[model samples]
Target: MTRMIFVNLPVTDLGASMAFYQALGFENNPTFTDETAACMVWSETISVMLLTHDKWRTFTSRPIPPATSSEVMLAISCESREAVDDMNEAAAANGGTADINPLQDLGFMYNRNLADPDGHVWEAMWMDMAAMPTDT
Candidate 1:
């Protein structure tokens, strides 16, 4: 069987969080969605679970960090640099913050950073395997 990953995130507003992820090209899976959480599908193998703060507390004792504290950076791989830029554009247009840092170009890889309205950091990146440099 293929492995799948589910990233659970805490959100203050379920509706807004859903919209924020949708803008970043995630499709909502209603089969696993409810008032407390929304299942956002990035692909067949990846899904993000947006859970309200209250709902989140049920599963963990750790306090939800405020928006100002960025503890994690969620990175997603894109097909090309254009796709990365497109995701950043869509994020900016959908009430999310875009371009937290300058564009990255390392010969074979490029990336951009974006933050959702609630301040979850997401890095969109593209890499050219053929152009990659290896010492080995």
Candidate 2:
């Protein structure tokens, strides 16, 4: 058996959020989708569940922060720096805000952050293990 991760996020507009995620490379799984919720498959082991605010409230009583507030930053790895940049571009071209943080380059690693229309933060990163300096 393998472990899987399902991140549930509250979306004000289900359709727009679905589109936003798709632009960033996730595929919507119709099997778990409905008017109030959509299952976005990032990989076989990672799925992002976008739930409407109404549907989300059913699971928790915590108030959703205003769209301007940052809650959590979900970090995802990419194969190369180009891959990270591409996702950030796609996210901004669609509806998200790109460069929420300055681009970070640490010789062996690179990172960029973006915010979705609903204000969910996603960190796109790339790392080259072979290029990393070894401990003496």
Candidate 3:
């Protein structure tokens, strides 16, 4: 069986977080959703667990870093360049903010960055398969 990945992120508001993801075309998985967290299904293999700050605190005794000051950024790839633009638009319409950087267009790839309500950065990228290297 193929391995699946679940990324857990902290959010200030569960409902708004869920709505933000939904705007990006992700659907909530009812099977693992509750008041504390919602399982957002991005694909068959990828899922994001949006956990409320209070719930996330239970996992660690140390203080949780605020999204604005997070050390790592999350990136998600789209099927096409148009999809990347669409996602960015959706994010803005759903309460997220677009990044300040200029758009990147390298012929073979296109990318844009956005920040969620809590300021977690997410990059939406699209890569051309034709430009990718193949195994020897």
Candidate 4:
């Protein structure tokens, strides 16, 4: 069986969060979504579950960190530099904040970071494997 990853996030507004993700090219999976939670699929093997605070608490008793806190930053690969820029722009156009981190350009790899309305950081990157520098 193929393995899959489901990233669950605690959101303040379910509808707004859904819209924010949708703008970034995620498709909502209604089968796993409802009023309290939404399943936003980025690809066949990757999906993000946006759950309201109440729904999130049911899964863990740990306190939900404030939006300013950063426990982890999720990343996704892009097809090209243009694609990375587009993703960052789309995120900013929506409810997300763009350029949360310094732009990275290392000849073969490029990356941009953005934060969702809930302040969950996401990095969109593009890499050219063939152009990567190799140590002699």
By lDDT, the best candidate is 4
On residues 41-86, what C-alpha lDDT tens digit does candidate 4 reach at each position? 9999999999999999999999999999999999999899999999
Which scores greater on TM-score, model 1 or model 2?
2
**Candidate numbers, best TM-score first, in rank order:** 4, 2, 1, 3
Model 4: residues with Cα > 4 Å off, grouped in runs: none
- Model 2, which residues run further than 4 Å from truth? none
The CA lDDT of each predicted structure is 0.93, 0.95, 0.87, 0.96
Work out candidate 4's RMSD over C-alphas.
0.6
Q: Global CA lDDT of candidate 2, please?
A: 0.95
Which lDDT tens digits does candidate 1 get at residues 5-93?
99999999999989988988899999999999999999999999999999999999999998877999989999889999999999999
Better of 1 and 4 by TM-score: 4
Q: Report the C-alpha lDDT of model 2 over 1-136, residue by residue, as the tens digit.
A: 7999999999999999999999999999999999999999999999999999999999999999998998899999888899999999999998999999999999899999999989999999999999999989
Residue clash pairs of candidate 1: none
Each model's number of backbone clashes?
0, 0, 0, 0
In model 3, how large is the Cα lDDT of residue 17?
96
Estimate the TM-score for candidate 1.
Answer: 0.95
RMSD of each: 1.1, 0.8, 2.2, 0.6
> Candidate 2 at residue 68, lDDT?
90
Question: Residue 106 deviation, candidate 3, in Å?
Answer: 0.7
Q: For model 3, how does the per-residue alpha-carbon lDDT over 12-131 read when each residue is reduced to its tens digit?
A: 999999999999989999999999999999999999999898988888766767765855678899999989999999888998987535788888888998888877788899999799
